[model samples]
Target: MNIVACVKQVPDTEAQIKVKPDGSGIEEGGIKWVMNPYDEFGVEEALRLKEKNGGEVTIVCVGPARAMETIRTALAMGADKGIHISDPAFDGADAYTTASALAAAIKGIPHDIVFCGQRAIDDDSAQVGAVLAELLEIPQVTVVTKLEFAGNSVKVIRPIEGAQLLIECPFPCVVTAQKGLNEPRYASLPGIMKAKKKPVDVKDAGALGVSTDRKARVVRFVPPPARAAGKIICADDTPEGKAAELAKLLREEAKVI
Candidate 1:
């Protein structure tokens, strides 16, 4: 199996997010970054499939130069190689442009399967995987929690509202892995050393014929309003007084009563 998994670098989930002074975009200072967590499932699943079939797994990510760190992490975890498609134009490109860039990169490689996270952590756009499949004109599944190989076909189990649906599809398909699909393993010390020797391919969006600078641009960014402080009144507090206070705040202050 030649599995191509798409990964990404995102602001660390624990990092503090702040907008620029003029609200043009993220402050981009004093922020730590890491691999998109959801993408870990896709990487793990690809590695597992390679172990079973004795094939190759390649990871792809698009971001700034620092994004290579995220790719290196995957290589340490056992991917054969990685490709980074990035440029300044990609800084604020929307999901459509991003997907186009990915498809262009994938078009240059022949693989039996493509794996991706159900959604990116930063944008949470579940659009890329599905859009890339459409551009590639291949069968694809999303929100897949379980996968099994059977002869020439593969069976996928996807969670529904309260249950799951088991669907079978042929090989050479795309799948967006969901969380809990598998536990991601840590790279051993030796593996980390080996990753340094792994090959990394870097390409820009222009090389892929997809311009990162699109018609849309980030005009500004503003943080959400701060949460209001909460107050705790003793259970014995007067119910009438509490109700009256809530009414006054909702009606007079909130103005949405």
Candidate 2:
């Protein structure tokens, strides 16, 4: 099955994110990082595919040195090895640049199937898998909920607005996993220990021979405005009066009506 799963490290969903005063980026200090939830499904699916077809699963990630933890997390979950792309040039890189780095790394490996999350939690840009597929000149299927092997090809189910589409794609294809795909397994004690010794090939932008030019960049990151406090309508003397007052407030002050 020679599967390749692309993953990312992101701030925990429960973590309180603070934007920098300069609006360049968020404050990394005191922030807890974890593997993207959507990518976990892709890793789980890759592990399952390897267990069934008898091959290895490789994890590919692009981030700073801290991202090695995310690759190790996937390794602890049963991936065979990892490729960590860490370089200063990739800082604040857009989806196209990130996908370019991933494609460069995967180009040197044996991959029959490439798995990625439908969208990264940090960026929420569901473009990497498709971009990588295009760069690799291979087919792609996005937001896949269910997948089944069919000899040299695979069948996948993708949900739309109100309906679903069943697609059959050949080998050497990219698949973006959706939430309903599968449940991710926790790393066991033995797996965790083994992951510490697993091989991880670290590469830089130069090693991958990828250009640093970005298709787009984040100019600034601004925090949302604070919410206003709620108002009470306790001045009304009776229930009917309160109702009338509320209506008046809605229609005049709030102007919602």
Candidate 3:
């Protein structure tokens, strides 16, 4: 089995993010970057599959030069190598353009299965995996929580609104991993040392023969509005007094009851 895991570098979830003054994007100077959290599940799933099936696992990413750190992190987690799609032209590209480039790069490599995160935290668009599958002309199962291999096919379970959907797809397919897929493993000291020497192939849009024209553009970014403070009801010590005050507040202020 030859498994390819698509990973991305994104702002750390807990980091305090600030929008740039120009309203173009976030302030990146002081922000901490890490591998996209959801992509960790995809990498871990790929590693596990390789361990069980006796094959190689490759990590692929598309980003600026800083993204090499993200790729090395996956290498430390046991991916055999990495492919980085890096170019200034790809800087402001949208999800479709990114998927097109990634699909083109993957075409140059041998792969039986492709894995990706359900979504990128930064954009939260959740469109790349499905779009990549379309570009590759392969079957795709998104938000997969469980996966099992059988002969030449793979069975997967994905979450719906209130239940899980079971799906079976053949090899040369794409799978976008969800939160419950598996717990990602940390890199050991030896693994980290070995990762420093692993091969990471860097390519650009032209190298992949993909256009960088963005179909979608971000006009501006607005931060969410601040939350309002909650109201507290203080009545006399009696339970009835408190109950009556709460009732009045709910009826007049909250208006939910």
lDDT of 3 by residue, 191-218 (tens): 9999999999999988889999999999
Error of 3 at 200 (Å): 0.6
Q: Give the poorly placed runs of model 2, Cα more than 4 Å off.
A: 232-257
Q: Order the candidates by lDDT, highest first — what do you get?
A: 2, 3, 1
> How big is the positional error of residue 27 in model 2, measured in Å on the Cα after superposition?
0.6
Least lDDT summed over 10 consecutive residues: which range in candidate 1?
Answer: 211-220
- For 141-233, candidate 2 gives per-residue lDDT tens digits of 999999998878899999999999999999999999999999999999999999999999999999899997898988999898888988878
Candidate 1: tens digits of C-alpha lDDT, residues 1-257 = 77899998988899888888888888778889888887889999999988998789989898899999889899999999989987887887777788888888888887788998999878777888998888888889889989897766679999989898999978788899998889988988888899999998889866788766565455767899898897653344799877877777779877997
Question: Any runs in candidate 1 off by more than 4 Å, and if so which?
Answer: 213-218, 237-257
User: Is 1 or 2 the stronger prediction by lDDT?
Assistant: 2
Flag regions of model 3 displaced more than 4 Å.
Answer: 236-248
TM-score of 2: 0.91
Total clashes in model 2, counting residue pairs 3 or more apart in sequence or in different chains: 0
TM match of model 3 to true structure: 0.94
Candidates' TM-scores? 0.88, 0.91, 0.94
lDDT of each: 0.86, 0.94, 0.94
